[model samples]
Target: MVDIKSWIFKDCCLVFSLLCISIVGITTGDQEVLTNSWLVELSEGGEAAARDIAKRAGFSYVSPVLGSDTEFHFIHNAVPKTRFRRSILHTRKLKSHPFVKRAVQQTGFVRSKRGYKPLKGVLLSDLHINNPEIGQLINDEKDVVIGKDPTDPLFDKEWFLKNRGQSGGIKGLDLNVEAAWGMGFTGKGVTTAIMDDGIDYLHEDLKYNYNSEASYDFSSNDHFPYPRYTDTWFNSHGTRCAGEIAAARDNDVCGVGVAYDSKVAGLRMLDQPFMTDLIEANAMGHMPNIIDIYSASWGPTDDGKTVDGPRNLTMRAIVKGVNEGRNGKGNIYVWASGDGGQEDDCNCDGYAASMWTISINSATNDGQTAGYDESCSSTLASTFSNGKSTIRDAGVATTDLYNNCTTTHSGTSAAAPEAAGIFALALEANRNLTWRDMQHLTVLTSKRNRLFDPYLKHFWQYNGAGLEFNHLFGYGVLDAGAMVYMANHWKPLPERFHCTAGSIKKEMNFGTNEPITLTIDTDACKGTDNEVNFLEHLQAFVTVKSSYRGNIVMHLTSPMNTTSMILSQRPNDDEHKNGFTRWPFMTTHTWAEAPRGTWTLRVENIAGKNNEYDDGLFREWTLVLHGTRDPPYHHQDADEENQTKLFKVKRMHDMAMKN
Candidate 1:
């Protein structure tokens, strides 16, 4: 009666579908066992059907996946004798359901907070005290004025807000929030959700602006997202980040926040035993309509070797948020560039390099790159973090745990929140700005000012669009005043389009010290619906194998002769078993450049003087260009536009003649 052959074929299909499930060795209480949790993606409008299917399958229905309408998380209490049998049976049962589209068993992955660890010589306590010289510097710079400055005790020490050569720092090398504040834009009606350990919402400085409706604790499955108290104060990170964004002004608490009037919500998902894909998805997708910005200061291990990013559910949630969130205006996601220093490359970390996120880098108050900063082309802009000098308050001043305050908040973690707060101010000025619009504003409004690579390893160079960018500092440090002003007068960018310019599927090999240079001449899909005349972001999807992955380096040269060091040397990434497979290495260094010329990519392995390893294989390279046919900026000259139109008409005529 049972067709064994047919049953086997069906079971194979079910197994393939279930491959979406992330398999990791997770041990619970010294026993390796499944979590008994399943993430199921059902057909649209299939909630009632999902519930009925769950009941028939001897499972209990959980809430809808927080950020997804068609996905739900379900639980099972039945314990079969063998985990493999149970998994197989459950996979078949879920697949048999007419409403269930896909199902995956949730597994755990290690997600690290991007905070900087203690350096060998730096004393954390040295950052807690304000230098007496700072007050004198502020007083001496009377010409540099902010209207009716906040009276918070630490306001003067908040040099990132208004740098004036304090504590061995350069003058006017700050976020320029004062000018925006003077213009009366204090992030009045924006909400930014901090997805981290937890926020000390009850703190005096943060309580007034804390948004409970947008807060959730996926770690404990509750709404109260308060940090768990500990003697080590390990969970004070989220609180410090919150204060950087929405700490109340003139409250005599800590220094005033960048957007002191903005609302801050806590999404505590990191303080758990192990992180799951569903948890990450829920945190990102939670209340996207209500929460305008999601500030993430964490990612995969910054140890230079680990290459990890969002899993299935989390990836879908992020896509959904950008496509459907904020009433379809799009949710702004600000991510901290990795803190792997010279050892790690942010491009290897998918979250920071993703096109969906605005990857933020850190600059010191002295207008130099921090010693621990990673060099990557994906970095969009810079924000002030701590410096190496102990002579001044080298860390960010923000609220800490248990109604306390600290002046030592450091790392790209601190830098990301500052950008989030600035974006909140811009949002308050213009609520209709889309996610892409925020990025465009960042590129247009960021300033070079005095930012430079102190090591001189990376120099600022002008792209084809005449926009200066560097691997270390991106477009340059963020100018809050300029950003807010631009936001007020900004028009929505044209509908975005992407064109796959070229791909090389054949594998090629290169010897040590001998570089491999590949070229792709593309018209950027001319005379097509997906034509991208102006470039916003360029991605090189590469699949390569190396004996020592860390030694591999890549350079992408745009048609404008602007070269972007997309993949930098990582001394710590020695992963030999598996090299990059279809990893999308992105770059903002070529922003607004034309994508219609000969693009050159140079891949090399400089294995030091010893020639340490054997040859590496380059399997594939695919170039994708994202932009609009029309120029996105008003600064484009009339001549350029005339040329673009003429080219379009000529190309169309030629195509018609061919037809």
Candidate 2:
């Protein structure tokens, strides 16, 4: 009964206003501006007092009541740039000022984040042919069907399900979905939403399971998220992705979904050529309660050359979904890591690189990392995609645009929806799984990809617990049988625990040649609610100044003697005159590691064009750890009320942004 869409629009309007006011120092092509902005958190009192403080400083104030009460934003503009920064500094003396957080700029990416590491020998063209071995396999093994499954007359060619090796793919390299199906978990009762271009509900394979009530088209401003792709090969993307999630079984025209009995909706939003922060926020927050899992296969350009992610508005929406959707059980967010393997890093793109998303990478039918896929420390697991090497044109077979069926759908784009269907199966097994719980199950159940991996020696890192990891393959491929079994028996984890280190502001000078290291003691995580025994995610907020930002590199080391390649140097990012402005570099490499000692963040100015303009400072850094604690702190559904009204960002936004 609640008008959730209306609420989100109001919130987006609020953000637009705030951003318009908060961008005090940014310059347009024809303008020269001198302004300084600050994100101020009040020690006490209401927005009126904060506005009064802003008035006293002769500045403008804007408060976007995004669920938090103690924070407000202010801007002061003046000429003589020095006077701008100086006048803004005066707010630090305000009696109500508790924490005056400055935004830090940052850049760089780990190899996985950079999407630069390409598979040994792979091509870009998508092959539309069937498995090169399908014909031979049918003759040699007589049991292999040609056109469709014996039970579902139209599903026989879904080699990713029937026979992974039928076309020369690795034997048993598939997600092992058939084994789970035998166990009677067909993904019934669970629902998924494809947050992509659009889905063809009229397709014989997907119409039966389409849930229109939960769908919307932000791009065309309609509730029907139908495919509008007319002449291009790309328009079928969303339909193909959806078929992977909930294509009807037995009543099928194409291969069945990973979760055949599961319901799916297409919340089409990405139809246009350009998008703003508001459009994305609307798409992400659409009917959060009704949609159990949101499968998104898009993110900032994976060109491996750009570094960007969801701005403040969209991030708040994601946090809101995780904390409030699914009747407080939390919504599952399955994301495509990236398809920019040849040129970009997934870590450089905030969405796939965030600790909050289940970054799913692509593994080919032969069980190798896809050449076009991005690698990253944040990738939780992987799924099947087009085998780019021997099987250049072979892709996942699913329903296509015009109510058609095709075998050419590929990329991390296809991989994510497959994972989403798997998630639906997991959800059906245990509807109580929270977002974090799902992440734990993913990490615990995913089996290491022991296929013909060439980078095993270089990519492999022992979690010190015999559990192996590598940014290249995450925890390896998704084992459907393994994940579903674990999901059915999963005992909920303790409430989320957290801790932070090195909040002190410090300035470090960097010469053109020296590498500097900053250490912070995480002793605060001993036994409090913030204690961290095993890390799930770790973040570093940083600000830097550099002329050639691409020349910088950074790393973080744990007390356990493990090192994380947080930032790998990027060469193509030479066009930027700015360094990181409070950009967060995230890593999932701390898996199973304890956090109770000294942690180190190291920065090296490997090849900057100039340090003579030593105004560049390693301003300050804060290390945050999100892990687990025993006897979980008294749980409360603080975000529940937010479903009916605006939700405050509370501590999330304060730290999520430069504030």
Candidate 3:
């Protein structure tokens, strides 16, 4: 019942008492976490097969190595790797006598004639037992000196900033903000544009910092985007979000924001009830140069079924905002990753799953995954938000509509503005960062899988660039100080590149008992200007006719075998709807992965309900790969955010697309 992580820290240092506890716990007893360390690579096996291997090998399975089907990575829970009782300290080497080659190569690798393969093995000696976010092996040259705590009277209650287990919160598990604040980065000059319902610009906490010129009410033709709520009380959502990003500091009414000194401009649109592609597009590009970051708390319905994205004009506007905003520095967009609970997938929401927007999810005050959390490969980072437990008080405190302050702002809605606020601070630290630059900063500085969540599918996954990722937590929690520290010295990235595959009109039989996989090649990706080496985001557009949309579970697998749960079966989504009508499903799983060979997308009618309209038509399917050119294809520019260099765009490999 004790948080072992807390024991690791004493007197403001990782004292020996905790280390001895962990070390003693490992060397003496059957501690599931400490004893479950193993560096396993399967000759052949998928996740299920790997689980079976772990069961047979007397180990508890955590996750495959970065979602690799060919490799098996499990933990030893007992001493010396016995059945159910695995030990790490008691053994130096593990015997995988029965855990040999389970790999099923699609293109096929070389086979051995002697019925024996040279088994390859390696060990990661420094990995924390189940905690990948403890810290990375970064060569940081700057001193991380935390600033003095804010003088706000209620600052101690703001556990998300400095947590010491207040009200069920975890100590030192909040958005690592103390150090950033210490560096004097309070989002001094940056501006965030809130594309939500409205904001309470008159609120004492957010009045002086409101950017009037950039603020607009799209729902009403008003100059000030004020939260006008006479009926719906929660219409103060925008104001709450703004408060999270730029609430006043010392003279605080509620609590201070992540970027307390930053300016916020509200662009109200959701209150209109009916918004078109043009309306959303205008909201997206409201003030490209003036609005430094676009923070949106609303997206398609989070009912675990609705699949909606931006229309044509909106897409173009977003693309333009990133390409031409900030005097060609690329305008940044921060979007809440949707609070659909575990039943929903963010891939179904276009705005959250978009390649341009930095999708943000929520963690909780207790350092656990919020119950209303959705999972996706596109999730970049997570920030602390309220937990779903009514008995607990994990909600955030911010400005309310009637010039009052509320402390109940929760969900991914509140998380996005927190990210925007942090990003504003980062932007203030480094003004020349392009949109891609900010993404790079997030990937590098954001905390990776911190074992505290307990919901991680895998502890650590290495992308093509060797970056770690987890399914439930994405790249990990937001590290405000680390991001600002990196932002101060961050460089520019290479120019954007785009590559596409063929659009095949296909169909699916609702009465099928087996799963269907549509495969495509990438030879076309070897164009002069469109060739891609590794990937940033991969998008698939599909149209289907289905009676029960919830019966579908679609997965997209890259050539590297990294599978993305694009659309999972949402039980509540039982309504008969047009399934995947040109819906663009995006994934960040292929980050830094080479776009070559055959990519497979599997679609299955999970329920297999033999009913009317059981048969579904694929209609058409298309893929677009966006990434930078890898080595051997063209001259690689290490500067990831430098837009002046449009990049070499040379073909990394011959993209024999659709071969």
Query: What is candidate 3's lDDT per residue for 1-659, written digit by digit as tens?
Result: 11123222222232221111110001111333222344455555457766776676666665443224655445454442223333432232334445454321111011001101122111112111221112222223345442345554445556777776776776677786766776668899899998877888887778899999998875565687776665546466787778888888777366688899899998987764334443576688777889999988777667675655665446656767877788788889998888887777877677788878999888887767787778776788888777444644456766667666655677788788889988998898889988887886776567753424566543556554445666667777888877887678664555566666656676546443356778987763675666776677787766664566666777888776777777776666664545666666777766666777777888776663344335455666677777766432233232232222213122222332222
Per residue, candidate 2 scores C-alpha lDDT tens digits across 1-659 of: 11234333544653343211121111122233232444556655667767877787666664423434665545455422122123434554444344333321111111111121112211212322222222222221212224323244334456566554655576667786765665567899888988877888887778889999988886566688886755444556778788887888765266678999999988876765444454566677778788999888887665445666776656777777877888877778888988876345666667777666798988777767777877666788888777653553366777776666766677888889889988888888788888887886777667675543555533666653335567777877777766666676666666565566455368787755677888888674665545656567877766665555555678888876777777665655553455665566788777655665788888876664343322346876767777764422122121121212112211222232221
Worst lDDT run of 10 residues, candidate 3, spans: 107-116
Ten-residue stretch with the least lDDT total in model 2: 104-113
Q: Top model by TM-score, which number? A: 1
Writing each residue's lDDT as its tens digit, candidate 1 over 321-438 gives 7877898888999999978888778887778888889999999888888877777989999998886567656778788887777767888999999999999999998898999989
Clashing pairs in 1: none
- Where is model 2 more than 4 Å wrong at Cα? 1-157, 389-393, 451-457, 509-513, 605-617, 631-659
Ranking by lDDT: 1, 3, 2
TM-score of 1: 0.85
In terms of lDDT, model 2 sits at 0.64
> TM-score order of candidates, best first?
1, 2, 3
Q: Give stretches of model 1 more than 4 Å off.
A: 1-36, 43-45, 48-60, 66-69, 75-102, 116-146, 608-610, 635-659
